[model samples]
Target: MGPGEVAAILFGGFALLIILRVPVAFALALAVTPVFFIEPRLTPLLLMREMFKSYNAFVLLAVPFFLLAANLMNGAGITDRLIRLSQALVGHLPGGLGHVNVVVSMLFAGISGSSTADAAGIGSLLIPQMKKEGYDTSFSVAITACSSVMGVVIPPSILMVVWGGLMSVSIGGLFLAGVIPGLLIAGSQMLTVYIYAKRRNYPVSVRSNLRELISAVTGASLALVTPLIIIGGIVGGFFTPTEASVVAVLYSLVLGVLLYRTVPIRRLPSILYDSARFAAISLFCIGTASAFGWCLAYFKIPAALVSQIEMLGLGLIGTGIMVALAFLIIGMFIDAIPAIIILGTVLMPVTEHVGMNPIHFAIIGVVSLSFGLITPPYGLCLLIAASIGKIRLVDTLKDVLVLLVPMLLVLLAIILLPSVILFLPRLFMPQFVG
Candidate 1:
């Protein structure tokens, strides 16, 4: 079959399976079956081989370890401490609890590197409080889900690890690139909260006293050190990303078990189990998605598509916008990791053709995919938040879209101005970024 024929079968089968509600990992694996049977050169065994090869990478080890760290933080009551700090820092703003939710997610994003962990940990605590404070239920869930997207956009991100490992971009550069955009997204969300609170007359928290701020900061000091350890260690050349993940896990254990004594020793087993379970799900998607990606590459589909797009003679900014739009659409349907493996590879040539920087392209993809966490169809974060609020997913759609406006603007900025992502990377990791 021609490359076009293979592309049709692969994407069509995957779309049908997704519409049928088959799990994404299974759908990806299943979608390639027809190509295997139809194309004489391919075999079913190749699927297993590609999946195994995808897992054999040393860098990918960071994924599970980072997940463990997030779970440890939640189990150890580190989340609670961060919440206290967020309250002290931002609670006096209009829509106090809403701002607190965004602030805590930003802080937790620094440590956890997992949006689902942020949503589950912060949403469980704050959603109820927001409701009790007479904040609209849908709005509370929407804000929680939206803010949680920062987890993946900030440093120590699982998506960045996958993108770097797969695309051969610098993990440190990607980490640094994420900082400004993540903070921008957080700032925009806070502004949205301010507007919402003003319109609805949501309660504002009393401005914290100096003593209260100090106490909150002191309480969360250890937890705050986590991002520093993970990001600092990587940027300072003290360790690799994978090593940083292990360090994060060990530090979290020390804080939870030895320092705070909040997490009972007996709880260790369950935390490990949960972390392993989530890691497996994420990693499995990577395996299948890699296999699917392999099929596209084996057919030279990306090259063909690139040639077609190149014919249009699109400029750097135009190509960047196109890349961002593609990621946003794909992210709405699939998880980010697989999307990176499948789409990132395809677009790499397009970006490179226009002389776009790898770090700049990566930040665009990561920030765009972060939106998927809140959007529907595959909105895992939104689903988790809605479930926690005991509300239908549709109920939160209005608030979710409304809050996404500022985030979309930040995404546009990243696309239009490469400096938005490149500045920090060039400053901190000049060798890798250029």
Candidate 2:
């Protein structure tokens, strides 16, 4: 078989493994074996070496720290202050507290960096309150599911750190680029909530006076400062992303221990274990993907694919569209980590060839897959949101479909213009390159 044909078959086999529910790390290792055999540069020994090399980066050390920070915030009763603060700020709006949940989640997302955390913590507090206000249970769950996606886009996101690790991009720059867009999506989501509120003639609650506002802000301030501190330090050259994460861990500990005093000191051990456990899974998957990518590189698969694409003479915009669509489709089935790792091998090279910044492509790639966490039968965060809110998956799907247009438009803007991500990093830190 021809080289191109062989590459296609190997890629197909890897995808099939993911579809069959095989773990992503295993899928990468399994799919890579044949390509290694087919192409002489990829010895099994070299694949093992590649896997070892993956975690060799000091930047990758940021993943566990960010993850531990998230776990710390979640366990330390940070969500309660956020929820209370949100209620104080927006509980008086029509549809009152539902709008509050979205805004609060957007606010907290900067710190949590996880849709699962946003969904679980915010949904727990707001869903029941939503039902108490005479809102549809399904709609309540739906909004919670949708709003949680903000966690990925907001600053201090571990997922962005993961992207930085994979692509050698500036994680701080990525965080800055995301701020405006994240707020834009939050505005869109708030509008969606308003539409439902207006349609239902929902009653607005009035719980906040000036004093209450001051109190709520003060309460949420500690939890809120973590993101600003982490991002600011990274951008201001005060710390690397890894160091920023360590600072976040300390900051979160203060919130949980000295400031809030909700979680006992003894609880830190279990939280560390759980956070490390989750971090290990992601790291292993990334490592295996590194091994798989090494095999593909040895075979020169990506370079060969680029040659074939240029022969099509499709031009840059056409190729960008094609790549975006492909990532979206892949996103529907595979989780973001595996998708990024696999795409980093084949697709990232195309962007580089086109003179696109890896950072810009990373933003596009992340947003495209971020939508996947809300769609269909396999959206992990969506399922979690639904279960917590006590609504059926179909109900949440309907709400998510409403926002898909805006989501796609945002992705298109990132891909077509590229400046949506690039301009910020350039304006703030000219030296930073993805």
Candidate 3:
């Protein structure tokens, strides 16, 4: 069969599996079946070989280590200390604990780099507290879900590592690219919360005196140092991004076990087991999605896509906006990792054709996909937060929409002013820029 015909069956079959509620890994594997049977020189065994090769890269090792590190930190007393610190810093704002939730997620995002992990770790702690403080359940879930998206946009982000590894962009540069945009999103979310708090007369948290603020900062200092260790090590050439993940794990272990003594020895086994399970699921999707991407490359689908995009006569900014919209739509349906694996390679050529920087292209894609963590049909972060609060996803949509407006605006700004994404990368790592 021809490439177009095979592409149809592969994607159409995959869509059917999605409708059937099959896991993304298995669905991707199953989607390749028709290609093997139709192509004259291929076999099902090639699919297995592709899957195996995907996980062989050393850089990919960072995924599991980062996951383990986040799990360890969450099990320790880090979340409590960070929460107290956020309360001391911003809890006096109009939104009170609502503002606390945003600041804490921003801090935790620097550590975990996984939105689901942020939601699972921080949401589990604060959702109930927000409820007890008379905040609406839907609003609580909305803010937690909205703010958790920063986990993927900030430095130490697992999503950036995966995109960098796959696309051959500098992981350190991608880390630099994400910093300003992530902070902008966090700041906007806090402002949104403040407006809502004023309108609803949400209670303000008691302002922390100097002693209390110092104590909270002192307690959280060890936890706050994690992002510095990872980012500084990578940017300083002290370690590669892969090696930085190991450093993160070691630092978390020392902080949790030796310093705080909160993560007991008994909890180690369960934590390792759970981290392994989550990592397995994530890595498996990466493998399957890589195989799926291999099929696209083998058939030259991306070139075909480039031709189509070129015919649209879009300039760089227009092309960027189009790509951002496409990723946002895709993210709403699938997890970000698999989306990055399957689509990142396919779309790189499109961006390159228009004189866009690879790092800028990557940041645009990463920021757009970050919203998928909260958008419906998939919305993993939103589901996690809602489940923690015992509320429905639909109930949070109104508030979520209110929050997404500024996020979308920030995305537009990134597209229109590429310097917003490229400035820090060029300043700190000029060699990485195109």
Question: Per-residue lDDT for 175-266 in model 2, tens only?
Answer: 88778667767877777778878988877888799998899899888788888798888889998988988898888888788877877989
Collision pairs in model 1: none
Clashes of 3: 0
Cα lDDT, model 3, residue 22: 95
The C-alpha RMSD of each candidate to the native structure, in angstroms, is 0.9, 2.1, 0.9
Best by lDDT: 1
Residue 365 Cα positional deviation in candidate 3, in Å, after optimal superposition: 1.1
**How would you encode candidate 1's per-residue C-alpha lDDT over 151-236 as one tens digit per residue?**
99999899999999988889989999999999999999999999999999999989999999999999999999999998889999
**At residue 241, what lDDT does model 2 achieve?**
89
Cα error, candidate 2, residue 398 (Å): 1.6
Better of 1 and 3 by lDDT: 1
Where does candidate 1 stray beyond 4 Å? none
TM-score of 3: 0.98
User: Each prediction's Cα lDDT score?
Assistant: 0.94, 0.79, 0.92
lDDT tens string, model 3, 1-434?
65678679888998899989998889988998779777878898998899999999999999999999999999996889999999999999898899999999999999988888899999999999999989999999999999999999998999999999988999999999999999999989988999999999998988999999999999999899999999989988999999999999999999889999999999999999998999999999999999999998999989998998899998899989998998999899888888998888888999999999999889999999999989999999999999999998898999999999999999998899888788888988889885
Ranking according to lDDT, highest score first: 1, 3, 2
